[model samples]
Target: MAKAKWRSVDGIVLLNKPIGLSSNQALQRVRRLFQAAKAGHTGALDPLATGMLPLCLGEATKFSQYLLDADKRYLTCIQLGKRTTTGDREGDILTEESVPSLSDESLESILDGFRGEIEQIPPMYSALKHEGKPLYEYARQGIVIERKRRRVTISNLTLVSRTADTLTLDIQCSKGTYIRTIGEDIGEALGCGAHLHSLHRISTAGYSPENMMTMEEFEAISEQGYEALDAHLLPMDTAVEYFTKVDLPETDTMNMMFGRTIPSPVSLDNGTVVRMFDQGTQRFLGLGQIKGTMLRPFRLVNTSEFSL
Candidate 1:
C-alpha cells in the first residue's frame, strides 16, 4: 500500500490525553487522524499522567511556544506514607514511614509553606538533559547526578479531598512546576512520605478541560469524514489570545509581512507584545512587538490562504 498523503492544515487541537501514552505518542496518533503535513505538541505529559495536550498543526506550530510558557492546572492524588525513587507510583519504594493522624488545620499549615515562589530540585528520573543525555538515562544506570534548584511558582494549591492514606489537591502553577515534586515535598512536610499516585491536568494556557477531545471522540469523528475532523480545529490566533491586539492598515500590514518595521498607529507600551491583524480585512497578520514607537514583526503567518 502507498504511504498516507499529508496536507497543509493549520489550527490547534485541544486533546485530552489519556494515561499510559507519552505526549508524543498521542500527537502522532492525532496527526495521522488529521493527516497533517506538520504538527507539534505544546507541552509534554509523562506516560503516567494525562490531561490537555494541545496539538498544533501546520503554521500553528509557530505559536506553540506561547502556550508552552503559560500556566498549568492539575488535580493530583498523593499516596502518603511511602516515598519512591521517581517520586511517583511508577518508581520503586525508597522508604516507608508511618503516616501521622493529621488534621485539616495542620495539613493546611504545611501546604501554605509551599505556596507562592519556592525552589525545586529537578528529579533524577526526568527528561532534563545532563551532558547531552537525559537524566533518566543516568537514573536507569544507577548513576545519580547533582542538579541545581530552580525557582517555580505555585499560584494556587488547595486541598481537594483526603482519605486515611491519600490526599488529593488542585494545583494551579507556573510552567516547569512538577506535580511529583510537590507531592514529595508535601509528604515531607506532613512528617510522612508521599508519592504521586495519579495526576490529571485540568487546564493550561486558558484552555479548560471542557475544550479537550479524547482519542475515542476524535476517532468517532474521523469516521464521519475529514470535514468533521477539521471542524474541531481552532484558529491559529487562539494561541496568542492573551496578548494585546494591534490592528494595522493594509499598507503597514504588507510592510511588516516583508520584515520592515512600521510606525505604530496605536499607543502601546514599548516592549509590549501584540497580536497583529489587518483592520479592513480582519485577517490575522501575525505577532509584533512595540519598540521605539514602531511595530516590529516577531513572527508573521503564512498568508497564502488569505486574500490580504
Candidate 2:
C-alpha cells in the first residue's frame, strides 16, 4: 500500500464553525481534509459561538496578523434575569435577578448607550495570558484577578428583537470586543442582569458566513477527492487585499528576502502597510511597511526560497 500523495496548496478557507467545537478542532478537521503541511486560524472562536473562522493553509498562515486585526460582526442572544461566572451559558450561574418588564422602545434606548468607543475588562475565563499563565487557569481554581480595562470600539450595535426573557442583538465592533461583556453591560444598564445564551459570529471583516463551509461539509467533500476540497480555498492574498500593493524588481525582491530595507517604486509615507510582489510574475513576496522612503520587511514568506 502507498501513502496518499499530498499537494502543497496555500490559501485561506472561510470556515462556518458549528456550535460546541473549539476553533482548534475546526482547524484540525480542515487540515486533515487538505493534508496541508502547515495551517492556522486567524482568530479563535469560543466553543459556544459559531461562524466565519478563516483557516490559513500553508503560506497563508504568514498573513494571519492582518485578519486578526480586522473588525468582526456577531449576532448574539442574551437571557435576562441571570448572571454567569463566565458571562455565558457555559459558566455556572452566579446570581439571578428579577426581570424588569421592558418595551422595545426602552431596550433600544439602552442598547444605544453601548455604541461607540467604550472600555471593557476581559472575562476571567479567557485565553489572555497573565504572567505566563492563561487567565482561564486561575479562573478554574476559583481565583479572581483584576483585569485592566482596554478601550474597544463598538461601531454599531442594535437590538434586533426582544422577548420577555431573551433579547437578540446585532453588533459590529473592533478587534477584542467581547459580546458576553456587552450582554452583561446591557443587563446592568437595564437594572436587571443578563448572561449570554447563544452567540453566532456572522462575519469577520469581509469574510461572511455565506462563504463559509461547515466541518461536515468539508469532510464530505474530502471523502470524495482533494480536487473537491481545493475548489473551496481562497487565495493566500485574501486577507491582505486592503493593503497597498507594491511591485518590486528582482533586485529588490532579493533584498527583501534577505530582510534588507530597500527603496520601493511607490511614494508611501511612514508606517503604511504594503503588500510586496515580484515584478515579472507578480507573485506575492510578503508584506512590507513604509518608514519614510524605505520599505522595511514586516513579515516575509519563505525568505530562504527568494534569497539571492
Candidate 3:
C-alpha cells in the first residue's frame, strides 16, 4: 500500500452528523477523507444527538471558536412523565408521574414562561469541567457537585408538535444553553417530570443543517476522488463573516504582518474585531482589533492557501 500523503486542507465542512457518534469522531472521519494536516470541530454533540457539526480543516481551525460562541437552534423531543438521572434517555429513570391533560393554550403558556433570558443549571452529566475533571466523571462516581445557575438567552421557544406523552420543541438559544435542562424545566412547569428523548441541531451561527452532508454521503463522495471531497469545503473566512470587513493598503498590511499596529480608515468602535483583507486583490489577510485609531493584529492567517 502507498504511504498516506496528507495535505493542508483549509476550510469548513458542515456535517449532518448521525446519532451515536461524538463530534470528534465525525471530525476525524472527515479529516481522513480529505487527508487534512489539521482539523477541529466548533463544538460537541452528544452521542444520542444528531445534525450539524461544523468541522474545521487546516487554517480554518483558527476561527472555530467564533462558531462555538454563536447561537444554536435545535429541534428536540421531550418525553413527559419520566425523569432520568442524566436528564436524557441515556440515564436510568429516576421517577415517573402522570402527564397533565394539557391544552394548546396551556402548553403555549408553559413555553412562554421559558422564552427570553432565563437562568439554567448546567447538567452534571455534561462535558463541563470541575476541578480539572469532567463533570460527567463525577456524576458517574455519584458525586453531586453544587452547580450555579447561569444566564442564557432563549430567543425563541415554540411548540412544534404534541402527543399524549411526548412534546416536540423548536428552540433558538445563546451559547451555553442546555436543551435537556429546558426539557426538564418544561416538564416541571407542566407538573410532570421529563427527559430529552431525541435532539437535532438545525443551525449554528449562520450555517444550516440543510447544507450539511451525512457521513454516508461523504463516504460515497470520497470514493469518486479527493477533488470531489475537497469540493465540499467552505472557505476559512466563512466562519468569520459576522465580523466587520476592513481592507488595508500594502503599507498598513505589511506593518500589521510584522506585528505593528497601523492607522485604519474604518471607524469601528474601539476593541471591535474585524476581518482584514488586502485592499488591492481582496485577499483575506487575517483578523485585527480596532484600538483607538489603529488596527492591531490579533490572529493572523499562516498561509495564502485560504483567501477570500
**Candidate 1 residue-wise lDDT, 1-308, digit = tens:** 22259988899999999999999999999999989999999989999998999999999999999999999999999999999989999999999999999788988988999899999998888888999998999999999999999999999999999999999999999998888999998899887889999999998888867889999999889887778999999989999998898888889978977889999887888998899999888888889998978889888888766666
lDDT of 3 by residue, 1-308 (tens): 12268887788999999999988888898888888999999889999999999999988899999999999999999999999999999999999999989789878888998999999999999999989998999999999999999999999998898999999999999999999999999989988899999999999997967789999998888888878888888878889998999988887777776778899779989999999987877777779999999889899888444332
lDDT of 1: 0.91
Could you give the candidate ranking by lDDT, starting with the highest? 1, 3, 2
lDDT score at residue 118, model 1, on the 0-100 scale: 94
> What's the lDDT for all of these models?
0.91, 0.87, 0.89
TM-score for each candidate, following the candidate numbering: 0.96, 0.91, 0.95
- Candidate 1: minimum summed lDDT over ten consecutive residues — where? 1-10
Backbone clash total for model 2 is 0
Q: Which structure is stronger by TM-score: 2 or 3?
A: 3
Q: Which candidate is the best by TM-score?
A: 1
What overall lDDT, based on C-alpha atoms, would model 3 receive against the true structure? 0.89
lDDT of 2 at 301: 79
